[model samples]
Target chain A: MTRPPPRILLVEDTPTQAEVAKALLRDMGLEIRHAETAGRALADALANPPDAILLDLELPDFGGFELMQKLRAEGVEAAIIVVTANASVNTAVEAMRQGAMDFIVKPYAKARLTVTLNNALEKRALTQELKTVKAQLSRDRFFGFIGASAAMQAVYRTIEGVAASRASVFITGESGTGKELAAEAVHKASPRAAKPFVALNCGAIPRDLLESEVFGHVKGAFTGATDNRVGAAKQADGGTLFLDEIGEMPLEMQVKLLRFVQTGSFQPVGASRPEKVDVRFVCATNRDPLAEVEAGRFREDLYYRLYVVPVELPPLRERGTDSVLIARALLATLSREEGKHFRGFSPEAERAIMAYAWPGNVRQLQNVVRNVVVLHDAEVVEPAMLPPMLLRAAIRPTAPHLTPMAAPVVAPVVAAAPVVAAPAMAEPAVAEPVPVQALPVPLPEPIFVPVPPSPPALALPPLPPPLPSVPVIEPLAVMEKRLILAALAETSQDVARAAALLEINPSTVYRKLQAWKTAGEIP
Target chain B: MHALRLQPLGLCHRLGVWVEPKVDRLASRWHHCHVTVLDPSIAGQLAEDLPRADFLLIINTFRDDLARLTQELTAAAATGDHHSFHRAAHSLAGAAAAVGALRLEASARLGMADEASTAPPPPGLSARIATEAQAALAALAALAQGPG
Candidate 1:
């Protein structure tokens, strides 16, 4: 009975149409129930569950969008097909966005209905399969790169594509989003896997000694160049040169690096002849290079050269349950290496992982899991094993539900299950709800007065006269808030630069940030 | 069950039961001992044209719009002219085909149809009007008895 023909709840107001629909479904060997109005439909759904719903867009009581939201609030997971007369792609997109499984235009024949029903069922099956596969692969890997989540697989695919290519690669994301590890993964997967994959923090090195260190000096290129040494670029000539924090590279050095990437030739500092070197350029930055270009800080041409086949890493907070998936994998890897037997996460630990904003992203996650594994004596890791900062951060409220951002990122991870699984897991999450408290019930009034010659249309809200009312926020507050939020996001909730962005003071941003330290929202 | 064939007349609101004189004439012929169903969306338009007369008719069918219909039916009701309200009830009676008070709906509909033609009332028209008037009076009396 559980796997019987997909049951569809047909919500149509007209009795004649409802009967016809029921007959069609009966022909398909499917079971159906009908409700006449949106209110009645919602009540019926709450009373008796259906596998899927065929909803008429037009109802005498309320619109489809509102009905879908009400259904979602009640936790009905039925696949909904919006049977509508409207054909605009916009309406379709809106319907899909509002959690409709699919949209079918009305006046459809029995054949079209069958096809739609089958496709919806198939997609449901595919989603369950994905979840199963994700659960299986979650116990593998180090860092937060666990599982064969399609998102991760796509990352792996992109890594494979550019790993052997000598062309420079740019990796971009907010800080702690695992840009460096991705570069390393590419290097490890490439033909040069056996060779040394040297990494240099471009932002960490001083400008004066950077060139000499990179190119190898004649023992006197700078104050600290007392001994003759090969620079990172030279050392990595036969391997991969991973430029971490490439966004912080000085403009002048960027020009030089750009030239080297272009010609594969560069002279050592104070050296006469340009030497040919076969090295791959892999760079990463937390900054949006396009924004840096606009600010006249980063070179435009250099940006394009390095940005070829750019890979963007999703931030940790948006990774949904993959946070737990990656954490579990990291725990397994560390446990085996450390010769410890660990079973699984305690309930509290799971809750912490689910709730944390994860501003430091994959790096932070990897560190937290490793720390928990190393410190915990029990067979399972619990909340107490988490860092004090993380433990405290997890309890704070995150503004705006994370579902909208999390669903897309975690979808592929859960989308790899089997062809034979139950399919409800793959449907998109319901859209954000309008505040019920703020909304007022609409009262029907006789607003349409019959005109002399034409049939009456409802009286429209009055149009504004000549000058439009425009409200502008005070410049200082607007700019400060923007800077603070961006800085907090970029630095993974680090208070310092978020303050600097305001330009008024880091101390002020820090003070405000301290008061507003809710988890995940800052990130 | 007895079925009465429908007779169509050109004049509107003819069954005399505290409605327009014309409507009252039409309504009495069909009111009581008949089935009448009204379609609100359609009856709504006609109600607007003869505001005063229609107001009294609405009060008769709905049985609670006395305050508003009193103004429209003042001239008729004051002189014991139940034509306007009768006409309104007759229209409502015609429209209430699916889910309204059946006997009342029938009487009102019959009343409007009878009032439509200028001819003197039909054989059962007078008796039907008296019976319907009693029912309408009882409904109004009950409504007044209930708490607002």
Candidate 2:
């Protein structure tokens, strides 16, 4: 049987642009579903769950950023290609930073769109693959290391290959990607596995004290040298020396380090002759040493020396589903540690976890899992149990609840003389709908109802003081507000753009008008 | 009326892996000791020859190129030609492994091996390979910067 082309949800507000985009994508044989409002988009996405989503940055109801956040929160993993007109480097960077798969500026040809979609699809595949690897990694542990991804497996292989050898190994990865785990794994696998696996952060210590910390100091060597102390290099002479963030070390210290690795000899601060020692160097960093060398921050000689055999740890995001896999494992570990009877995440919670773009990687995931276990009471943690920030993110398109503004048909009786009149220019319905009944102040004598008059009315009464002149009254704010309310009512107030069009600056609008609703002036 | 309702407060616990401090400093010093054994001129020789002191570069490179390489391979396979694809795939396979993109490297190797089995390559293979391979190579090249 011949299968139809993949159906794609195109969420755009403008009719003309939507038609054009639909046609462009349709020509490539993709079936398109158009959603003009955020509410409609959310409903359609949830209902059908298209294979891919083509989103507009600017929506009538919500900004694209928040919409993406919402989709992610809902665990919608469909390939999303942001179709945006507001294309700037900052916006692109921000979008990519926000986990957008691919970005294309406005006025792009169908070819460009197709290319971007293809690239996005490929990335999506890799992301899925990584997730699978993570699942595997979560179950296995070699030494103190824990991971299942192919990257981790490779690290495991390298650890096995190098642990028995006396030759040095350099471990590398971004901050928090478990480079230390790799080092420890190697140390545990080595002949000196029984000895202490001493670790160091090169960037943390001051330049002056670094040498003393590594090579030891005699009791009378310096002002702070009150007692004879063995340095890290001396202390770990028979074991493994795990250097972390090694790129941050100063050039002066690099020379002394070179002497130790070359001859396995070092001198105390007060002693003259060199002291013989035996140790293996395992360096790690988030910084690129080669770039540092090219930039003259790191010595090319030092870099070549450490390059002998290298082990690289993949970042959390790249490790794919391993993030969630690891999170689940961590949850179990944490639950046991806290002595809590916490079950895993609820379905909604799981979706939220998978969708979050973890910039801090594993460390961030671990922290979140730990928090969930300790803070919440329920055995199975629901989405609501998550942090407010995350819940806010999950909502995505928070269309502000629009209240029909109750206008005074007449000006206030006790108020000062009427203000100066402005021109009777036609105003667009650009201002958001503020529920009149919710206003803190009393409504005017005559209220402009959202519903249209029985007969087609020609003119509308002038807006009262403080309420700007709105040209059209019938079927404007009231109609949209009613539509949004109906949708929200249907969706149980999830506010995934279906219930209301969340304004960008919602708090301000709600704050100014909140008193009216409470005063019972207008409902 | 906007009700300022505060719900039942729930507690959250956060845990982080504690890293032993200053071990990297000693390690870097010792690391420097090992480098002094090698000839200074050999340090900058091959991009692949450099120390894996910082794997972030490799990760970044894979991030930047993995998609491009995939696209190229798919396009080559679709077009039924793959000389450039073979070359691109081989290089990328090595580069991907170096940075820990096992899936990508595996895919590239598969594609490269497939290309070699054919006596005469298909059409449009070179352009597809060139485009994708160039992108992936450029990204991986940029990763050789420093300790990161």
Candidate 3:
């Protein structure tokens, strides 16, 4: 629907002046209302406010400035333009100080009046638009999450839909993608909110102690079991038990966990009888649980039993602008904690924050903001205040090159074909020559250049020695294959021990070996 | 009061002229203006700035204010009251300035010079203002009756 024309209230005591102003306004296709006294103008304005007001300073009842004050006090937000015969600078200043948008000396030209009115109207429109955007931002904030992106909105909706249900919820996301927070939100939104919310990270505990941690052990059950302790299952009797890194739970533990889940009962260590308790299970994993099941590391029955409701959280990279919002919030909080005066990030800093893909998600953003707050003492966070690695990731065009046996890196490789065909340890292909000098820190050029890969010879040195002359760069894929074979030979072909020595996931090692075997690259 | 109010219209009728409604309509349609008439020396500036309809509106308002202030000035002059005469003359000056009546404005300003005096306005000052008012009304009526 089309909006009505702007209404203008003209407050002039003189009949001739009022008639002239009305004619000009009507000619401009505006709705005009005339009042001969300040009292009438105030009453009309308070009753039905117009878009703009043309006020004469000398009124029969009171001064126009006082009327302006009254209008402000009463919250009538019409744009007031002081139209007075007095052209004194003092009068103009006083009128503006009283909140008049503009001062027009009587008998103003048509062009001047038109331009001023249009400017006031445009300012009002911009203010209204800003108010609408703020309102949307506030609405987008749900539970503890601050994001308005479509992906996060869908996650919020899914959580709200499944919160009251009794079905188990399995959340899947990259590390630091707020899975535990999502589980807590589900518990808070459910009828079990008043009960305890127990959380245990399956991967963080030792395999021997994992079973006892889930279901309490009796006193003197074994070494380090001197006291009878209640476990997460009993602690979360009526509430949610959040098991983080469920994919990392050992196969033996998975059998007991599946039995407990099927019966809602568990046999504690050294306890003869079984103890029963009600629990709503919520599990999360950064790894792919289905892939773990296919590899026979996860029980397929337990996976089906717990994967009833799936909540896949979008990574911080996919959540546009949310990184900025989270950074600002973290800055405010971290500054308060550190007794700093930082209010927000500079535009360049915000741009960098938005451009970089946060592989570690909100956790990484929190650490980056905390690092700035603790190190810098300023009111605004500049790009120089950010961590060097974040700055490089943000400014660098392509993703960081990942070694085949190295742990997974979440950077987006723009040149997908080249990344696949090129050697694994090759330097990332520069789409264009970036001006590294523009960066605050002058980094060495060798950091961007390719270094020689470790040799594939079985007699591998502990570390590659610095070359006396320019060393020849080797293919990264060949070096990676040799390193794996060397590690396997040293560990007597034990993939798990080799993976441990390499500090990468055993599943990663297994997958690589299977790929090599299928291609007949290795026997 | 009635005779004073009818004076300008009667003068227009006696001159064998009447303001044409088409001229008022045409002027209203043609001109949408806002003018400042502060300088008394800018004679006929109001005529050039305003359409005939707007000029007539100001003229009518000036005529009414002139009749009321004229009565007040006559009473103050007869009663030897300088304060009332000064007040009436100040308002009459403003009214004259609204329509750019230079001669009437000058006469009213002269009457305002007795603001601090205990005695009444100067002799013949009221007559001077009355004469200027009559001449101004006649001129405004003639302007209104001109061709569109």
Scored by DockQ, the top model is 3
Q: What are the per-residue Cα lDDT tens digits for candidate 1 across A86-203? A: 5679989999999998888744555677788878867866776786667544534533255445556566667777877766778888887778888888788778888878899989
TM-score of chain B of each: 0.31, 0.39, 0.66
Instruction: Please identify model 2 stretches exceeding 4 Å from their true place.
Output: A1-139, A388-523, B1-148
- lDDT of every model, 2 decimals: 0.60, 0.59, 0.73
Ranking by lDDT: 3, 1, 2
TM-score winner: 3
Fnat values, candidates in order: 0.00, 0.00, 0.10
What lDDT tens digits, residue by residue, belong to model 3 across residues B40-100?
Answer: 2332555555566666776777677888889999998898787778778766765665555
> With candidate 1 superimposed using the best TM-score fit, by how many Å does residue A138's alpha carbon deviate from the native?
9.4
**For model 2, how does the per-residue alpha-carbon lDDT over B24-110 read when each residue is reduced to its tens digit?**
342243334332221222112223443443233434444455555556655666665556566456545544433333233333444
Question: What's the C-alpha lDDT at position B72 in model 2?
Answer: 62
| Cα shift from native, residue A311, model 2 (Å) | 1.5
DockQ of 3: 0.11
- How would you encode candidate 2's per-residue C-alpha lDDT over A1-523 as one tens digit per residue? 4866766888865443454455445546777798977778888888887767778786656788888888878888878888775557898888877777778765345567777776776676687789876754554566665566677777777888888998889877877788888888888888898887888888898878888888889998999799998889888878988888889888888877877777888898887777887788999988777888899988788888776788887776565456667777788899999998876777656655554455566787788888888886667867666653343233321212212333312222213322223335453223233332223232221222333224312111112123333523344345334433443454454455331222223343344235545776336
lDDT of 1 at A303: 90
Pitting candidate 2 against candidate 3, the one with the higher TM-score is 3
